[model samples]
Target: MENQSKKVTLFTPVKLGKFELAHRIVLPPLTRMRTVNGFIPNDWMVEYYSQRATKGGFLVTEGTVINETGHGYYGAPGIYTDEQVAGWKKVTAAVHEKGGIIFNQLFHVGRQSHRSLQPNGAEPIGASAIPHEDLVFTQQGWVPAEPNRALETAEVKALVKDYHQAALRAMEAGFDGVELHGANGYLIDQFLQDGTNHRTDAYGGSMENRVRLMIEVLEAMVDVWGSDAVGIRLGPSGTFNSMSDSDPIALFGYAAERLNELDLAYLHLIEPRINGNIEIADGLEPVASMHLRGIFKNKMIAAGGFDQAKAEDILEKGYADMVAFGRHFIANPDLVFRFKNGIPLASYDRETFYGGNEKGYTDYAFYEAYADA
Candidate 1:
């Protein structure tokens, strides 16, 4: 047992913001569409999280829409309504019961959303009127992304207010902290990327103007949660939802420097490899994480198709303070233990990953249980 424990570097404890994690293995935000109608977290969702909340480990909830208009995918949870906040309380209580730390990932789909999911069938909004040619999964099945209208300068303040109010609700829901979904070509990413944001306003054009909205939202969230209790996720080179920056090195390097000024809890960076897995763009260099590693003067998290060896290497080299696991955690509720003991992970069925009941969600057997059987 001692030998097993000593072999894994991921078992080491670290402090993230106000919470101290027992280990570096994090359950990153995954969009599992299993919430009840009206977008409330249900008992099933509570069980799902409780089963995976390793003692002293960190877990971030699925990408939860911040408001009604932020809804895009079916079954994703929301943090806007009183009922939704109350529903999430159960989830937070369960995780806390297991001595686990959880964060709510506040999300806004922006131009990536379909009109049917928008407020009163209204057109989706973005930094500009640019329409994403990609398709988004909705209740009616996959459909073409609706052309989005540019947010009026006045409306931008309201959008920031939405993020602020959502963070407040997250606190009421008992989350340890909140992570702004500034990655994955969502609303925040739309504003951050030049291809998606082409307006000649205060929010677009130069790299400084492009990063303004994200910084404003981060500042607003900081007002509610304090700098230590807030975190931001950035995909400096991610191409998901067809996102790309003209010069990721300059844009994200600046963003990291700016975010450092806020003293954020951590900067969760999606490695270029993970973003490339979704869409491999030629000449796309994976240097943002490495470059920002030197710039961001805070805890850094590196996530993307990482295995045990790679995670250990990154941590040992000080590339990241923590390593977040997605697919590995999905199929192994006792993932931390498995990694510590060198147990093989059960393969997950991709078909049942989203919009499903408990079959593929909580039914994955634990290491002990599977071995005993």
Candidate 2:
């Protein structure tokens, strides 16, 4: 038993805030575009998440809309309604039945949204009037929407309340914790990005000001769920939603340092790269994350193009405490096992990667089901 316990490399116990994770592997938040209506969790979502739960590691739910105005997808889950909380409760309960922990990732797409997805006649609100050059999937097909009115100071305060309410809803839905989706050019990311945020109010004009709303949101969530049960994800140099910063290093380094001061559960960071996997180039060797990781003594999770060899090497060198698997987790529910046993990975179906049925979502076979005996 002692040898078995000591030999558990990937299954080691790690402290993520108040929860003790049985493994250091995490299932990153992935958007499947499977929601049926404004914002509601479906049975397929329950099956999809429960299937991906690792016996040891943690699982973060897909980016869930916090309000009707935040609804950017047709099939994304929401935390604004009573029924939505009940639906997610079923999901969390099922994962708990298998002895796994899960957190709800709160999200709001700002300029990356289309008019069809917006609530009522309200335009899509952003940190600035600079609209995204990307197309959002809508019932009317892909259409260009103008930049939205900048959120007034009162509106920003309301956003903080929305975050708090969402955290409470997450608890009601039986999540072990909640993660703020502060990445991928969402509302929070929009505010953080220099190109998106050109305001001169207290929410912009400086690095500290740009990060004010995020900090307020975090504080509100902490008030609802406590600091130990909260986590935040950030993409320092990502250009997802027409996002760009004059000093990416300064923006993210400051954000990480502040997160460290808060002593939250974990800080998830997406590596910087334009296309494909983040290469281990000498110039972009996670200098900012390392600096932030040094400042923040809590659990640090890194995502974006991590394979088995790279993941193992990072762990062995202690670059990050936990590694989040995105596409790998999508195709292989037993991703940790596959990595540990050196089994060949089943490639994910690009066709069913987004806005699809259950073909690529839940039909991926496990090792035992297709083992070469």
Candidate 3:
């Protein structure tokens, strides 16, 4: 027992803020479009989250928009409305019933949104008037992204309030914590990267100016949930959504230093190889976590294309405190049990991943039934 105590495995317990996590396998936010009216969590979502929840395990909901203007894709969940908060209560209750800790990921997908998805059919807002370089999924099907207008100086400040309000709503809905969706090419990332942010205002220019919006937004949420219950995700090396920076190491390193001030619950970093859901060239060694780990003092989570061996390796080396599995969790409801018992994960069907029913959402059986079959 003394020899085993020295080893840090996926099942090892760790304290994240005030909660004692039973295991280090975290369920990061995934954009599964299974919500109902007004992008509200439905009964299916309750079942979906409950299936994945285990006693003392951690789970984060899909990227849930904070307000009406935050929508980007069709059917993504939101928490800005009274009805939406009530809907989310069912989801949080389900996870808690299984003794799992769940956090809601507050999101706003900037230029990645379309005019049709925007409130009053207005142009989506971003750091600048930069048009998205790729297609965005909308109710009209996959269509070329419409150009976004630069957010007015006043509007940018108002967004910090939006994040705070959303954090409050998350608390009301019975969530243990909330994570800001600052990663990928969302509203926060648009301001953080120099390539997209060409503004001369206080919100843009140098690295300090570019990172202001993210910092303000984090502070706003921290005010509502406190730093201990709030976390942030950052994809410093992610180029998805046409995101680019002159120098990622310096940019993210500086951001990490700033994040230390908040003393956030954890800083989730995506691997350089992960471009959203797909994996790109992985010839490079683990860079983002390796560097940011030295800067960010709190627990760190490293995600993207990680298997059992790779996940364990980083944990053992003290590079990351946890590993988030997306595709595997989508296929294996009892992922913790499977990993503990050496059960092979079931293959996931990509076709049914988005905008789907029970086929890929909650029908993935538990390992006990799976083995019996």
Candidate 4:
């Protein structure tokens, strides 16, 4: 009876590396593409982040591009420029004002881009010159991703430097920590998975060479912010942006075990149920977090398709220390409070998920428990 009654509570406090949260719920990065011209965060972005902030809660900002050529969509925020850094300062301040811990999720979209989004119309750089019909949203509307050139050995090193500089700028922007976007078939994922990485160079042709870029990038980030302040997000079975791996379990297991040496903030895992940002019915591929929990052996945050019951269950079973809600947080600004108080959540409108003003962005209301009293 005692063992059966030992129900885990999401309202309880949990320590995640350098920070201690009042609750176990986390707001993961969600790219809404609502930044201003030149990919700068505006007042609307400030209010949006501020609205979601809670005392001692955690918020991971959307995948802020590290460089211009690394961008895959227009209006997606960047942290590379001085002006962009200034824009993010406002955002970080807003979240901090609410006493919320925030991290900048820095990334490069890799081959998930078109020539139009590149510098001087140069082909987007990736692990290799792989091309596919994975649509990247551009100024001209949804178009198939264009051919990308393989990054030379020297160019790969330069991109690691880019990540280091971006980490510095993120700290300058007043973010509490940083999460390297190594998932979702982005630059890092393109290097890790065999489907996208077809290079015979030192950066590929073997799992060590393939994972080297991501490991080096994380090492660079740790140099800026201590190991305790850095986190990594990975998706083992995620096929988003045409991603695949011949041996996901072996590849991801080795990567997770390697990550344990860093003693980083957390390993945020995206479930195989999630394809990119949306939930999908994937045939029995196994949950990525379940497969990786024991191997990573550090703080882990499981994301993708989690609700109140599911989130509590994961914590009870010790699969992840916290749960990240992207789509749910979009509709419920006071999501942490809702979870704490056992209140019903509002459903989100998928049509207004991307490239919108205040419709599905910041207009979500808080739960009114004592209305008409």
Report the lDDT tens digits of candidate 2 across residue range 182-289.
Answer: 988889998987978998999998999999999999998899888899999988788765678998888888887777667798888887742222243433465435
Output the TM-score of candidate 1.
0.94
lDDT of 1 by residue, 1-373 (tens): 0123334378887888898889999999988889858899999899999988978999999999998888778789999999999999999999999999999999898888888888889998888887567877788877888888999999988999999999999999999899998998999999998988898989999988988999999998999999988999888778888898888888889888899889999999887777523424434333555678889988888888888887887777676888888888889988887888888998887877888799999999898753442
Superpose all Cα atoms of candidate 2 onto the true structure and report the RMSD in Å to 1 decimal.
3.6
- In order of lDDT, best first, we have 3, 4, 1, 2
Model 2 clash number: 1
**Model 2 weakest lDDT span, ten residues long:** 1-10
TM-score for candidate 2, please give it: 0.92
User: Which candidate tops TM-score?
Assistant: 3
Local accuracy by lDDT, each model: 0.86, 0.79, 0.88, 0.87
User: How big is the positional error of residue 34 in model 1, measured in Å on the Cα after superposition?
Assistant: 0.7
| Per-residue alpha-carbon lDDT of candidate 3 for residues 236-306, written as tens digits (9 for 90 to 100) | 87899899999888999999999999999999888888887887865555689999988999988888888
TM-score of each: 0.94, 0.92, 0.96, 0.95
Clashing pairs in 4: none
Off by over 4 Å in 2: 1-9, 141-145, 274-288, 369-373
Instruction: Single out the weakest 10-residue window by summed lDDT for candidate 4.
Output: 1-10
Off-target runs (Cα >4 Å) in candidate 1 are 1-8, 276-286, 369-373
Greater lDDT among 2 and 3 belongs to 3
